[model samples]
Target chain A: MVSSPATARSFARQEGGAGLRDSVWGARELLVALVARNLRMRYQRSALGFLWVLLNPVLTTLIMVGVFRYVLHIPVDQYWGFLISGYFAWIFIVHSVTESAGTIREHSYMARTLAFPADVLVISTLMSRILEFVLEIILVASLLAVFRHGGVPAAFALLPLAVALLVGMALALAYPIAAASVFFKDVEFALPVGFTLLGYLSPVFYPLALVPEAWRDLYSLNPMVGLLGIFHAILYDGRVPPFSLFAISAVEVTILLVIGRQLFRWKRSLFAEIV
Target chain B: MSSDVPRIECVGVTKRFYHYEHRTTTLQEFVFRQLAGKPLHVRTPTFHLEGFDLTVRTGESVALVGANGSGKSTALRLIAGIYPPTTGSIVTRGRLVAVIELGTTFQPELTGIENVELYAAALGMRRREVQASLSSILDFAGVDEFAEVPLKYYSSGMRSRLAFSIALGSDPEILLLDEVLAVGDVSFRAKCYDRLAAYAANGGTMVVVSHDMDSLPMLCTRAVWLEGGRSRLDGSVDAVVQAYLQSVTSSS
Candidate 1:
């Protein structure tokens, strides 16, 4: 249908905006298709093919658990279980953060050609990592069962909320990183180092108790302290996180997600030019 | 403001792109530039097209004919909504699709059929629509025999033909076709032109970017001649074509 000239003059932005709003329903299917395509292409043409999915986490866990349990003697109880939970959470964060920054830079062509919301790309990046993360979870579960270290905690009902918060945290951090990278290529370098330092600061490989008495509270101020602590609680200790700590992490992540979304919308328009 | 809306209206449009004097794409160079306190090496903004005005009414078939670097392709892309004009405004209604740089979404590792879905989806068709039309698309391209083979194994012509076939299935209200008619065979090229004529006859607006003067008159009711980032002339196809021919021959 032909629109009047006044409305027609504003067509580029407004019409595309309406098309985006109308197609919010399509976002889910598009994201699923993108995730499927990425996963397929990732392992495509390799001789081993889909075996890499199972072998990757298994190998990483084996090497790290062997090193810490035998080589270093870190002195944590049930170190195998601890590393499984810790590494699971750590890998998701690291993989998602490092790759998310380049998501826009990588799919710059699609963003220019298709008028879909740019957030779909960022969310799909997270979804692809989440799919791989799901595989890691399966490996962890089977290994935990095999070793007699795995059991559902009493607070298992809350596990879904905890997982949601972790996803929220990744999305919060990833949105800004991907959106801003279009303006400044420097994000490409800063994010990997930042996430690496974050890995060391969090109690991923080591126990949280290793932190000294005076600094433990200050260190808990790092949001991941509470976030990963919940993962530890559910998977390792069979206990619920302290309600106060859990609330703090959830609130922190919600705030970051809100701000990151704003920054993303502001930056989305300029992407076609710089990308 | 009129009651009738043109399919596309680009008024006082100017697009300026940064011309980097140095290769500063790396982080090390960025840091060194900051440490040394030198000016950023983007020398200046060069206008790809400046103060260009165009209006394509509904059901209009327009041709942008220009020599290399004359901004015809840029104008086509602007109308296609590939990117916004750096300055001024463009208003377009309907589902716009630009077939410029086909096979951008083609993954070499993907099979021919897979790339068909991926490229069509990238052009704004839903996955279901792409699937529904996949057989017909393949049938027309005559790549049905190798649909399961990886695109990397296909010759360049095969790849383009597949991409072109998929693009044809993308239901666009306003189609932006850049000089992509060079299919693998002459029959397919004829098929493409026939489809083009049918689409235009059915009142589908189009902005065709090509330098071929012979084909220009056949496809366009109106022709625009562009030179040095300006709309040098726009008139009926025969008049503008003749004028453009005279100018090129007289000047050279």
Candidate 2:
């Protein structure tokens, strides 16, 4: 049986210039189907099901607000609102990196069998997290609107812009760690520890202002700071942040993404072997 | 091109695989490994292909016969562009699909239908196009009743049938089969071979690597015998098969 010329053409076009065009493009449909399967399997046996998407973030945000605002007496209104916004964003990065580190290793069977680009696994894993992140964004935005204190701001229009920046940052952080975990098994152990340190050091728990003034500049080098700062500004402050902050964030995000992709490619061949 | 150029070609290709220790019991050994400038016990990498050369023309069904670890699979992988050669190069001009580990490509958690779509998509079919052919593909795989079930639940025969169906369903210009005939029941294998015959009749090129010398005369126009990653004989399937079988029987 001959595949239609139209199907072949469309496949070639999607591949564009990559050497893996045929394999990668061919796997595209399968990628979507597989992802849908993963999504379904994830929700299938659980009693709570999809509700957990909303419930998990809401529960975590409540805990953070209760501890920081109620116990610490931070005196902030709509504190759950603020905590929810930042926590959801932080979770996106944490969850993506935590799970994706061993993506190739976990899928060793599929990797050896199918001829699709190995990067498709990375892309698929990222996509599942992204879908979940979108759900979190919607839930957090709805909660903020319903609560009505520190209500939705005009600057919220920039939320998409902030989300784009964070996604780039997350992908940047994930690539090298994912690649290294294939050969350097120690990276798997170190990843959780690194995420824990990054959790406290970044603005996930406390506002950046809490840090001593002299050390704040040094800390901003943590790209999460730039990402979280921008997200918090949009939700809590209701204003577009200063241009300098956005500019610095844009530069840092670009560098990390480029380097990450390079490292991932560099170690690509070893995946089938080591994994 | 006057059929001068080989449809499949490999020039002096070499591949090596390093073996790593299963587990190091102590941190001292781990540290000492790097400091010692060597492994405590290093297993030399096995060479799958070494300085191998071969050529097959258009419209030819080439059966590659070799014993276990004889570089048959490695050569096929190289031809399919799955792994680059450590030395030399592999050059080809058409789409190639290797039916190596069949349904293993399907994620176990996903349903059979989902796997068909995913595998088809990876081969470069668009979502809608794949959807249009979805029912037909399932019908051909003959597992329509179990289409909705997850792949992990499928029997080995069912998996083999489905994988072969999907691989052939795509209609690639070049097909590489790695001992897939050994899978499934006898009737299913017969059906697969019949389908493959039709595929070859349609001018599709095929390269099959198998230990079944009896089947070579029926399937292949010409065959190549590989030993230690080198071609030991090349001729009509019957002659090459006879030579290989004779060599093995006399040696034993």
Candidate 3:
């Protein structure tokens, strides 16, 4: 029932703009099925199942808190709250981008054989990661509540905006990266190194105050800095992020999305041939 | 809704594939090529199909008969919207379901029933439609007993059977089949033919690519014989299949 009665339609190429939106809207069922399959496959064989979603961030945060708090002796108070908030946001971006970059190649056979929108693969990968990240955010909020007698911050109401911005940024990057990775094997090899460098460059582990004032403008150009700053401001500092941070992040996401969508649309039809 | 209206049309359709030789697959290689004043990627274009045209009306069954690499499958894929034609236009009316390489979209780790839902969705079927047809699909594939088992455990025959059943259950207005009848055992294939015949008789538009000369006439009323991507002959199934068979024997 999704499609109406026969109407003359051309299938020469995938459409763009509103036509592309309609195609995606028509394909929403496929998107849901793909996301469901992705979630199931992620933990199907693991004995711990969904626990792995929580365990990954918890375990990684514990190690970082141990190192920064005890061994490295960083001066930030309530380092667990600071680290957990920023780390969860950072990991979400990292996992979504890294996994999405290779999703088209992983499902190349399906892309070639099936006629569904190829971008659905990238979107579904991000959706599954987003679902996992939502669960991880709950865990972070609980830990923050326990550590601080103030309970969860009221500013946390703005957390959805932060998550939305993070996802928008991730998708903007993922579309182009996923499309390019199909042709260039280098993307697969280069992503981890790029993320590693980005991790050090962003304010994921340490406080932004430690960053020298002069270098902050250049650092903020990374996009993740603004996004992580938003998370940190709301979750750890219990306040709204500066309007400038939201503005910068929004502008960057818009530009990246436009470029990413154009590049992805141009390259997708070629995928069935190449991949 | 008119029976005379064309369900599928191809106008001067041409498909070309580039054979990449020493393609630049890395940034370093691209940079080196730029420094050396060489093209970023080198490839030779080969035409798979050229200036091909066909039209299938509603309730019509057509057979694309050709040897391997003659563009029958490529044409089917182009019509199915899998690949954009390199230099032409393809228009289709009605919901289309293509069984090109069955089970290729199925995940290995997912159970049989799960894959059915996934595959149905891939074919553009909604969740409710898939759920409604789920039992019949499983029963037709004869994999109902193992519906909960992962597809990785299914035999090759079982996988194709399940895939074919799902495609048929989708109630497609236009169905494209590329040598799908070659799968499964004898009885199952007979069942597949029966299902396809029933579909064709029920006013479903079908363009099938098959080499089984005997069965092509049984299912299709007309045949288009392709040679090197161009239609060499187009006529009633009996005449075209006979001529094609004669060419094959005489050439051999």
Candidate 4:
């Protein structure tokens, strides 16, 4: 129906304000479809196809675990399990952020012609990483059963909570990078290095306890460290993370997400020009 | 005219873009001094739109005819809410779908059907709504057979046809056409004109941005002639098109 002229004029900003909210709710289907298409297209042309999904972490874990466990004499039972849980979670974060930072550049075609929230592109990037993580979880579960000679742990009940935490964290982290990368092309170039440094500093492969006592307290301030701790608690320790770590993870994720979302929303209108 | 409301109101709506003087070579230059804190700089940035004004009522199709750099697309971007005006105010009601730069919007890796869902949804159609519209859209584009194929594989003609079909099918209250019809095949072009004609007959507001004189009268009732970021003429399509054509012919 034709919206009256006056409404159209004022609606530019009002509808824009509402449109920003509606874009989140309205674009859900497009988001799912984009992610699914990428998943299928990525593997369809590969010779090894879906096998790479299982082999990637397995091979990485084998190399790391063997080196640290045999050569470095790190305790395999606690430490290997610790490394596995934290590293995979870290991989998901790094992969999602790095891939999503260039989402607008990669999908310039859609951005130029269509009017939609750019967040959907960022979501698609996160979605693919989530798919990979789900596969990693399945592989890790099977390995745990095979190696430990035990069925899945009871902490598996916390899977939903872990996923919720991951999604919130991804949203908080990815949008600002994704949104800004449009104008700042260097963001894409800079993310990989930043992620690698983050992996080393965030206790992805090493235990947080290895840090000097003085620094350990400050390093826990890295939000990913807390998130990784949560993952280790549920998967390796077979329990919920401490309330302190959980609270830190939640607060940091919430703050980053709110800030990232505001920045993204503020920048969204200008994207068509700069991009 | 309704005493209370104009369907669209641009009270001195203006837009100015910052153009960089030189492409910075290194990350240091690109980031720290050059890129970080400036939207406008005196070294090279030029402000284009001093004050652009226009208003449209419901069911009014206003063609914004201009030369290449006359800011037609910029105006449409402002109206679509894709880009906020750098200055002044713009108010618009209803859903606005801009069919500018067709085929430039689909994700290269996505299949035709997938791109259709994404593009249509971007226009604010719900998933169920797009699914309902999908068959008709594909049929209209005549690319139904290639529905599952990746968009990167589609020919330019096929892509434009599909893009146009989606844009037209969305039933936008205000449709912005930015020379999208100029690229498709002859028959496809004819079909687009026919569809646009029908859409206009149904009282859908439209704004066409084009340099094509022949096509203007066929699609528009009123036209605005733009030159060097200024409106040179605004009147019936025939008068403006004739005036533009005479000026161009004389200049050549």
Candidate 5:
């Protein structure tokens, strides 16, 4: 059916928030394609293919478990369980942020030629990482059920909320970082160091209790501190996180998302020219 | 909704590209500049288009003809909404598909058919639509035999033919072509011309950028000759092409 010229004009004249929504909503298929492209490219030539998605986190967890449990001997019961519950969540953030940082530059060709929302590139990167994270979580949950003597905990039901919160946080950071990377090539190079620092700073392998009492307040200030705390509570302790912790993280994620989204939108138009 | 309303309207459009002389593309350099009280980067604006105006009514097939750096491609890019005009406004009615750089969006590692799906999706074709057109797209590209082969294994001509096919598969209301006919063998080029002529005959609006002057009259009824960053002439394809050729030969 032919659309009225007035309807076409409205589509052409859309701007600011409304335009952004339209672009994203209209390009939903493109988003799915981009996510599929990323996943396909990642596993395209590899011998193991999809196995790496499952094996990667499991292997990393084992190495961390061996070091912290056997070599370093950090005292924590069901250490592997404790490690993976929080470790998987941390890896999700790390992978998403690191990959998102370079997403715009890597897909510069599409950005330059195609008229889709640039945000889709960053969002799809996060989506693909989220898919992998979901797979990793399934692996972690099943392992916890078998080894912990108690089948998957009741709090496992809250895993989706936890995943949602983590995804929000990842997206919140990713938007600005991806935009910044387009302007400054440093973002791509600097992200590894940042993630490395963030990994050690957040309680991925060790418990928060292990940190000296004096540093706890400052360390808790890290958004991941509260986020990982929830992951550990649900998957490690088989209990709900404190209401205060969940509330604070939610508020923080929302605020960061607004800021990141604004920064991305402001910088997005310049991308085709700059990249 | 009225037929009187032009399908495309560009009034006083201008685009400027900043060519950086000394740019800081790293945080380290940026921070050091801040500490040293120096500007982060120095750039000069180069106008690619200045007060460029165009209007295309329904069923009008327009060709932009120009020399290198004459901004014909930039004009098409602006019209395609790939780049926002630095000044003025552009209003385009209907779905637009631009075949600017063929196969640029295709992944070399992906199979020919996979790339076709990816490209079609990028052009904003729905999954069902893409699936419906899959066989026809492959058939037109003449890459059906190597549909399962990775794009890297296909020749450059095959890759572009497939790209062209996918872009057309969207069945866009407005089609923007940038020298796409330059690719593929003679038979394929003829097939493309036939398909495009059919598209125009069916009332599809088209804006094409091509250096192939001979093909312009066959494809477009009207032409705009751009000089520097502005439209120098707009008239029948024959008139504009004749003027542009005379200018080139006189200059040479």
Candidate 6:
């Protein structure tokens, strides 16, 4: 017989702002619940459920190490450390983009009934991947400890910021891609190929210093260029990334986020209808 | 904020749905469609809800009775704010909760209790708020035995009961339900009636879309007959229901 007062008050306000606050804060907790849900769903009913978190990167790293260190004969010092750190960050961007693209469309049922912000579907999917990323970071740390490259540089203290930048890069890409995927299913098809191409463009396997000086600035425009560059500086070299690198990355991320937010907000209204 | 003002108001609300051929939901389809140079058959955007209007005052229960595709659910959707009107405006007051499709928000892979948290969170309820009512919600759903198991294991009836329990816990002032009353077992239906009777007694306004004629007079004070998205009759339950029944029989 009783009625909740909060939503009524918000509706009575006659403006859009009041209700938005509920969603904004409400999504924060939902994010946690969803992340937890995804992790449980992923690992459910398997004896080696938790082990897969550790095992996935281990298996992937073994293949990459065989291909890059032995087959390609790339001459990078501490290639083991480089491969995992770079690989973990790259996987975050790649998985976030691919998964976020389908998040809204896949969860269309919720869009038809529930009133939570649609973008959180994209955001929470990214958060779940980020949680996986955090687990994989443990792998990176162990590898770094085992490799002891240059005694694990002092700049490694900035690992947290490096992770943030990687996540930022994912968010920027996920926003636009998630919205576009709803209207054009081709987005989902193109994303994995796009990420593969993006891998060669970014310094996933090789070092950025190796790319010629003339191409470096143009390459730095990739956003991930600066993001991964900082990641390499901290985790690989144990030195803080140059402020100039951070500056350009900061600009790129800002512009990317602005464009992403604009596109997502513009197209979000049509989603319930078209989806 | 005046006592006389209607809690929910729809003014000339018309919603159009584009009828896409081949859907063209992919870039490949779109490109192919463009290369085809605009097929001879051009589909015009059609209005599902054309010039529809309704006003439900506070403390009133209205049942929307219509045949399939008669815009019963569409009207409920518009009031729930799931879809915006293509033209005109809809102004709503008071807290509202709509249950259009049961289990739409459940994540089947999660445990029953976890799904409760997830569903409540998606419905815009804060965590501590759900936490305070957590046990009570579980009790009401009567699925506490399967709470720790993944929801995929639960039967459809259990899922619907879970969804209804979460919606009921919200205690919304305005409840927009679309064919949701026949949610659970016979015992649950009786329980729903007892609770709904109490809810109506507390001055809650509700708009329900149901074809269950026998339950009309017992559940609602007013009945709105919508034909093709337009309000055909809006009057006391018995009068409008009788008119609608006559129209159906004569047309058939």
Clashes of each: 0, 12, 0, 11, 1, 1
> Which 10 consecutive residues of model 6 chain A have the lowest summed lDDT?
A1-10
For model 3, residues B95-160, the per-residue Cα lDDT tens digits are 888899988888889999999999998888889999999999999999999999999999999999
Per-residue lDDT of model 5, residues A129-231, tens digit only: 8877898888778878788837767888989999999999999999999999998978877888998998899998799999999999999989999999999
The order of the candidates by TM-score, greatest first, is: 3, 5, 6, 2, 4, 1
Model 6's chain A TM-score stands at: 0.87
Higher-lDDT candidate among 1 and 3? 3
Looking at model 4, residue B131 earns an lDDT score of: 84
Error of 6 at A93 (Å): 0.6
Task: Judging by DockQ, tell me the better candidate of 3 and 5.
Answer: 3
Each model's DockQ score:
0.29, 0.27, 0.47, 0.34, 0.43, 0.36
- Candidate 1 per-residue lDDT, tens place, A10-93, comes to 334424312532344545556666776777787766768668766877788889989989999989888988888768877787
Off by over 4 Å in 1: A1-11, A14-29, A43-47, A108-115, A142-151, A180-191, B1-3, B22-24, B27-41
The residue pairs found clashing in candidate 3 are none
Cα deviation at B199, candidate 6, in Å, is 0.6
Per-residue CA lDDT of candidate 2, range B36-119, in tens? Answer: 786655455667877788776767899999788888998887776666566665666566678877677677777888788777
**Which ranges in model 4 have alpha carbons more than 4 Å from their true place?**
A1-11, A14-22, A44-47, A76-78, A149-151, B1-5, B23-27, B30-42
Judged by DockQ cut-offs, is candidate 6 incorrect, acceptable, medium or high?
acceptable
Compared with the true structure, all predictions reach lDDT values of: 0.76, 0.75, 0.86, 0.75, 0.85, 0.78
> What is the C-alpha local distance difference test score of candidate 6?
0.78
Instruction: Give candidate 4's error at residue B71 in angstroms.
Output: 1.6
| 1 versus 4: better lDDT goes to | 1
Estimate the lDDT of model 4.
Answer: 0.75
Cα lDDT, model 6, residue B13: 73
Q: In candidate 4, what are the lDDT values of residues A210-232, reduced to their tens digit?
A: 78899987887788878888887
For residue B16, what is the lDDT in candidate 3? 76
What's the candidate order when arranged by decreasing DockQ? 3, 5, 6, 4, 1, 2
Residue A249 of candidate 2: its Cα lDDT?
93
